[model samples]
Target: SFQIKINLTAPTLIFPGIEAHGPYSIVGKTDTSLIYLNNKDEKRVMYLVEIVKFCDATLEKVLNEVKLRIFQNKFWKKPPLLGELDLDIMKAYEREITKRLRHHKQIRRWESFVNGRPILPTMKHM
Candidate 1:
């Protein structure tokens, strides 16, 4: 899964908030969400990752981007691995999701999203 893209971006692992590909460092934004394989019985997760610079102008924008990405399902993070990442923004995101999506409940919480799609009731009209 370390394949390089034409633009040279690393392939991202297919975790929530991530675009499907082959790039990730095997981290997490929070412990609540988890990932697993279909053939083996193990739990896993890949949190969001972002590039940061050592300047005030970019520093001010970091928090805003974190919030924006969460709302847009762009990336995630796990504690300890990258402490600089702020997860407080997840509060607003969870509230908004409960308002807009059906049967989503609380993002990933302790429950696994079985097979990604079938966990939700079959939607014949899709």
Candidate 2:
């Protein structure tokens, strides 16, 4: 019988600073075994995935969406500022979206590398 093991850790997100959004990085590993019945040999393969939002998507699609405002010409339009509202709601949404994008990017980046190399670094594990 052959045995395979899979190990996954919690995802990690990093916020550079107030000005900079972040460079979502997801780091994890998996281990599996491939046994050759004829050759009586076993091979192990590791798989990893990461995605990076180094472009406008990070701010426009993600951040803006979470901001819950329509943006035109690089400007965000919010509801009338005449009402008093809970600031915590905005903060919670922002944090959640930020973390989600970061984790998602990490996975996407890894997948892109595995699929093919397009002027990008080669993936060590697939």
Candidate 3:
């Protein structure tokens, strides 16, 4: 699991996949993270389905929405990242889950390469 910081300027409106308002500095990665705004100025614990409303709503959609609000008109122009940049959730909220998928793919790829590496008998692991 990881954590994400909310964009300080994010809107307070509650939309699908959106929970509590923010200014949140360290939001948990789980869909059921208990840090949403509720009635009477209360800190409500959102259900897993509240933050993640199935297919109509998802972590990816939530990120995209945040990304849209963060970049506004420039969202489309943001350059695609080619490395492990997205793994660092501190720089900004993640806009795409592809990076995380890439993480697994890269690890597997590297593992295969390493496992298949040609090695001398003396260099083999005991």
Candidate 4:
């Protein structure tokens, strides 16, 4: 069996006088058998269906929808940091989410490479 795991750790930020929060993590895992017999029951191949499914769900459904929503609203507090950065804290949150998403994409690509099956280009390219 082969196992692949990926984790994204969100940073904890501290404004000058305010307390720190988070440094939370989100993890995704894939497990697959090394060999699978085909329909004819005469051939075995490196079975990566589980890994592909995991990567698809993690990158598209979980990361893009669920995690982005959490980062945009759930984990952010606006009024507290309004005075510190001299700008809307929402902007900072947006920047942080973008950075984290980019990092996650890179990690996914690297994981795909290591597993010998690269993923197709994401929606951004199309």
Candidate 5:
């Protein structure tokens, strides 16, 4: 008779130690972390998902503002086609602006997303 033994261990998850959102990037850290540049060209660390959502929300806000500005008669007397405005490039600008704004706000890596909702926290009783 032969005896056999096996060893099993879960792999360690590697975190990037930073995160980004729109032009605003946050740096702090969470259980998991990643590093990325925020809007202000500052390098920081945070939870990856936090930065992604933050940047996304910031970008949405920026785009809406840009659209409104473009509609203003001071900027454009005549309504312009989306194609004429090179929305593709404008999108890049929006992203950059969001990044910058986030940086200006001093968002560091691992910070919570805007609105401060818990990340998947279960409903709590009062």
Candidate 6:
């Protein structure tokens, strides 16, 4: 007969020599330890060092996705023909675009005022 002992401890940020935390998803567990999956779906051993590195890389990927979404949405307006095809979706897009543009304009105005400069500099100064 074989007796196996498992240490079912809640995940901790501190290891013997390293102190770091990660946002890893537990996919499975073995008799000895848990298994984790990183943002890229890569399997990682459930240890403090591996979890920390996986979380850092996952955070970077999330940030990049946020930037990509922002870039795609900014300055994007629905075509007029789209309104004819799908009125609700087109209207929603139009409203969102308008709101974003208004917010951008307000930010520009605030920046110019704070910096004591016109939003568009004079051609003579250019």
- Given candidate 1, what's the lDDT at residue 38? 19
Compared with the true structure, what per-residue lDDT tens digits does model 3 show for residues 8-118? 433223333434435322244543232333335544333333432222233454455445444543345655332233224422444234454456557766655677752
lDDT of 6 by residue, 6-109 (tens): 65555443233222323222122222222234456544444322322333344344334334434444445743322232333323333443444456667877
**In candidate 4, how many Å is residue 95 off?**
1.3
TM-score of decoy 5: 0.25
Model 4: residues >4 Å from true position, as ranges?
2-87, 121-126
> Model 5, range 22-103, lDDT digits (tens) per residue?
3222122333332334456554433333434344554455456555543552366576534433444344445555666667
Q: What residue pairs are clashing in model 2?
A: 50-106, 50-109, 50-110, 51-105, 51-106, 51-109
- With a 3 Å backbone cut-off (N, CA, C), the pairs that clash in candidate 3 are 20-37
Which residue segments of model 2 deviate by more than 4 Å?
A: 1-62, 65-85, 119-126
| Model 3: lDDT to the true structure | 0.40
Can you write out model 2's per-residue Cα lDDT over 1-126, one digit (the tens) per residue? Answer: 456875555323222231231112111223211111111222211111221212335333435543542222125354542112223333343555577677766877766776665434554444
Task: Put the candidates in lDDT order, highest first.
Answer: 5, 3, 6, 4, 2, 1
TM-scores for all predictions: 0.19, 0.30, 0.25, 0.31, 0.25, 0.30
Mark the 10 consecutive residues where model 4 has the least summed lDDT: 19-28
TM-score: model 6 vs. ground truth: 0.30
lDDT of each structure? Answer: 0.33, 0.35, 0.40, 0.36, 0.42, 0.39
Kindly state the number of residue pairs that clash in model 3.
1
Model 5 scores worst on lDDT over the 10 consecutive residues at 18-27
lDDT of 1 by residue, 65-98 (tens): 4345454444444333222343343433334333
- The regions of model 3 sitting more than 4 angstroms off are 1-57, 73-91, 95-98, 105-126
Model 3: ten consecutive residues of lowest lDDT? 82-91
Name the regions of candidate 6 deviating beyond 4 angstroms. 1-85, 122-126
